[model samples]
Target: MKRIEPLSAARRGVPRWLRRALGPVLLIALWHLVSITGVLPQEVLAGPSVVLTSAAKLVATGELQQAMWVSLGRALAGLAIGGTIGVSLAVLSGLSRLGEDLIDATVQMLRTVPNVALIPLLIIWLGIGEAPKIALIALGTAFPLYLNVYAGIRNVDASLIEAGRTLNLSRSAMIRHIILPGALPSALVGLRYSLGIAWLALVFGEQINATAGIGYLMANAREFFQTDVIVVCLAVYAFLGLAVDFIVRTLERIFLSWRPAFSGT
Candidate 1:
């Protein structure tokens, strides 16, 4: 009799839950081993226990909460501004060739330049304060929103537009009835993507000019060899990302309830 392959059997027969659990189990074990071995510098990367202790200290003092609020506020404000402007421009561009040509090249050029490269110029212009940080966040988020919205609008089914025209629907009515729904799913995807970039930009901004917030905490800790504080900062950053993503997922479900595929998942 031919021998069956062990690898194929494991791959096919193992439960997904077990597979997922195994990854984290292996990662934690590796992390524990690395911490014990001192391969990575203790100052740069503390073990789990040190991170947790730092977290507890920051929590009791309310420093953690304040940093979260500062970072979150910046990100949310940028999202609102960028999302609104991107959607508005996308609508205009979709309706008119003149708008499309005018808006397209300029946005494309701006998107190519890294946001961090603009920091020096921003500091010179807006000063080393909140304005530059907020502006950076907005800049980071705007392009993704703009690109996704514009693409979604442009790719709206030609047949649908023709059908609306055949039925003698006005331009506004056709856009409202047909175009909006088709394009909205993509817009939602862009919104989620932009929010992630906004968080990253906000963290980078804080690391530079700010005296407070998690990024600043990390930056300062690095200067003083306080690895535990650095670990706390990273934990806070990761936790916030998870919390924001959960909120976005919830919003996606509620707002896009009409999407049957998502509902099934």
Candidate 2:
């Protein structure tokens, strides 16, 4: 009888990176096959190969890089502004009932209104300038981050806080040593969500009277019926969102290393 290999041993032969890429590889293969099969019209949906070619051409011309940089700047600026405000508000509210009463209700009410809906008013007030676009991204990113950070702080163990008190820790010391560390995991979770929302907001905000950015490129492509260009812009958006999420995950691994939950990584 032929010797049977252990599953774990067999799996060890596959590179981890390859395993991670398997899903996307399969997806691209399926997409290519579908394109060749003509299940959808080429005008409606360009194949992965066509998108790749379009992306290469755009890159060679430096158009994609310039557009990407413009979009990236908008997204990052919005994220920085929104994240700062979110964390600040969350810290205040999480630390005191008075702050919660003052800030939480207004934030909650505003949360009910979609950020995209604010575009019209933003345009009217801020015009088609970069201000409205950045503001829209900020508005879209803030609430999720605020909610997450607040929840994380609130969810920190009472036992930990009490233990800090037992050690005669000062209020500020307790927050710095215990509360912040305990709340970090949740905050990172919020960061990941906020990054996703920032990208989404960028996509929406950039479409409005945009002269430079991935969304503008997509809009321009749509006007001329350049399906491949539109697809390339979409791929860039997807990649940027994924890249930000990966960065957040890296931060989590670095900061959350003390936790038992992350010991495996």
Candidate 3:
């Protein structure tokens, strides 16, 4: 059996920053070495230097910023729509047996259906507009939130619930005071874990008859064999994901200050 460490008592070293940075610094050095040694064809896999120059060009022309804004807007729009619906339905499902049985099976079935597989049908129905793209990201984001919230609500300790009941708390009062607070951490985790999938769904969604966006830029570059542009687009993807995840982690730290385990345990 795999051993599990108890996070409640575990703590990381204060100077862990250096250790954390070492892996990425080594990876970058290795990449530079491989490029210099001609381990890979330059035309297919351009050097980091070329990618940096292409990125500079894009930034100078404001193309990078424009594409970044469009992608971010789409992702946030979808997030708003999906997060609202997920939390609402999750609360309903957890509160009532009828709601749980009705929505749970349908959600499972939809989740099993690959989001990419819906692209063609979405393009046909929504016509490659913002509607289709937003819909795709929403679909990708919803299930995770639903699963996390439902699990979180269901797992709240019975003792705490009984205490609330003994205090003569109303059903709504218990949910608001005890259940939601208990479930908030897991729901936040779901949101944090979802940043990558939301970004990916936006990329794929933009691919359908796309006119603008970094994904479009990257795909168009592939046609002319511009590996540097492809690399730059991918770098943007990496940077954007990193920036968003950092923000989420910071938010988690602020809201979950009571949870010592999340503080590098």
Candidate 4:
């Protein structure tokens, strides 16, 4: 049998941050080369420089700021609503087999359904206002949270539960001290997943009759054939997703510090 070193061990000489950035650095270099080579029409696929220039213009005019705030508000609002419901249901299901049996089947069914597919029905029921958009984001975010949270809770070590019972800890005390802490890592994983889906859902929701949002900006730019503006909108979406992931990762490092596996060291 051949021996294979772990990637971290194999790359021990490389700085972790530099290694992490290698792919993106290469991708950008390739993009710049393609743009300079004129292999792709500039009008059809604007380069990073052109997109950055357009972003600067939009920022100077405050159009990007206004659209971003509206989109941010919608995303956050949906996340709050969906997150609350998800955590509550997950806790309920975690606390009892009866609760799990009652709620899990419906969640599993709905989780399989695409949130984007609900747009038409949501629009019909909630009208073309912010309600449908928020609803769509909520639907998209809820399932990831539920699945991860339920799994985290259910997977808590049985030995820990027995130890808590030996210590004669009350139900609430056991849950608070043992289960939630054990599940924190998985729950944070769910949070990261949900954040990504929230943005995806927001994009889908805003595409439908949106007057303000990154999606709306992209839609308007398409009408005027402004490739640069379209590229700017996509760049903004990418940046936002990265930002959300960073925040959640930071939270994990902080909250899961007690666990050596997750510690910042």
By TM-score, the best candidate is 2
Q: How do the residues 56-142 of candidate 1 rate in per-residue lDDT, one tens digit apiece? A: 988899988998888888888877887888888888886789998998888888899999999999999999888888888888888
Which 10-residue window in model 3 sums to the lowest lDDT?
6-15
Ranking the candidates on lDDT from highest down gives 2, 4, 3, 1
lDDT of 3 by residue, 1-265 (tens): 9888766445544457797889988987888789989997788698888788899999999998998888888888888888888878888898789999999888878889999999999989988778999999998888888889988898888999999999999999999999988888888888876678899898898887777888889889989999999988888888888898899888878987876673444
Per-candidate TM equals 0.86, 0.93, 0.91, 0.92
**Weakest ten-residue segment in model 4 by summed lDDT:** 256-265
lDDT tens string, model 2, 211-258? Answer: 999999999898999999998998899999988888888998898877
The regions of model 3 sitting more than 4 angstroms off are: 1-14, 262-265
lDDT of 4 at 167: 100
Q: Which candidate is the best by lDDT?
A: 2
For 1-265, candidate 4 gives per-residue lDDT tens digits of: 9899766677578788998899988998898889989987798788878878899999999999998889989999999999989988998988799999999998898889878778889999999999999999888888889989999999999999999999999999999999999988899999999999999898899988999999999999999999999988888888888988999999988998888772232
lDDT (C-alpha, whole model) for all candidates = 0.83, 0.91, 0.85, 0.90
Q: Would you give me the overall lDDT of model 4?
A: 0.90
Model 4 lDDT at residue 51: 79
